[model samples]
Target: MTDPADMIVPLLREMRAENLEQHEQTRALVRALDKRLGGVEDAQKSYRQALTADTLLSKLVTGEFEERIEALENKVRELEGHK
Candidate 1:
């Protein structure tokens, strides 16, 4: 006759191993998503800064637009922080 406790031990060990493997896989997927999100955020920030600079330059050709551009840029930066 089989010892029931001995039989159960191997089954439990296998289950624990499988659970650990699944947990590791999930952690890896979350890390990858985090990296991609960070890249997207950085790109967005760069684009906004470039746009602000361009607007300021265009206004420069006309004369005395710094105050308005500065205010707009400040608002954009504030919004970016919220994101």
Candidate 2:
């Protein structure tokens, strides 16, 4: 019969190698996840900046349009007074 010690040694070595391989695979997956999350965070920041710019532009347009309407109304009133 073959020695039990010889069989056990090879099995233990294979198990250690498998464990190392699995650890490396897990680390690689974590790195990939970190990169994807970083990209998502950058996109969110860009979207926020765009939203702020749009809000400011909308306010400016509304204020300018209101002022123009008021000026036109005043002109119409003056014309009626002169008639």
Candidate 3:
């Protein structure tokens, strides 16, 4: 009494619907992952800039100390030579 053709049509329709649903879900997941990856990249860039700035600041402080010591030593030598 059952018609094989009729059964086949309904099965095909169900498969099509399931395929479309899965495709949409995959697209949404890709969009979300892309957004999260962008955020992570931005954060990593900021961290690198902070590290570079800290290194430059440390070098400047060290240079300042060396300059001051050299100037002080020159003044002491000049005073001894005058006396």
Go through the candidates in order and give each one's C-alpha lDDT: 0.93, 0.99, 0.98
Comparing 1 with 2 on lDDT, the higher-scoring candidate is 2
RMSD of each: 16.2, 2.2, 1.9
Candidate achieving the largest TM-score: 3
50: Cα error in model 2, Å: 1.2
Ranking, lDDT, top scorer first: 2, 3, 1
> Residue pairs in steric clash, candidate 1?
none
Give the distance in Å from residue 64's predicted Cα in candidate 3 to where it truly belongs.
Answer: 1.5
Residue-level lDDT tens digits of model 1 in 1-83:
99998899899999999999999999999999999999999999999999999999887865656677888999999999999
- Sort by TM-score, top down from the best: 3, 2, 1
- Model 3: per-residue lDDT, tens digit, 27-54? 9999999999999999999999999999
lDDT of 1 at 78: 100
- lDDT tens per residue, model 2, 14-43: 999999999999999999999999999999
Worst 10 residues of 1 by lDDT: 59-68
* Residue 59 Cα positional deviation in candidate 2, in Å, after optimal superposition: 1.6
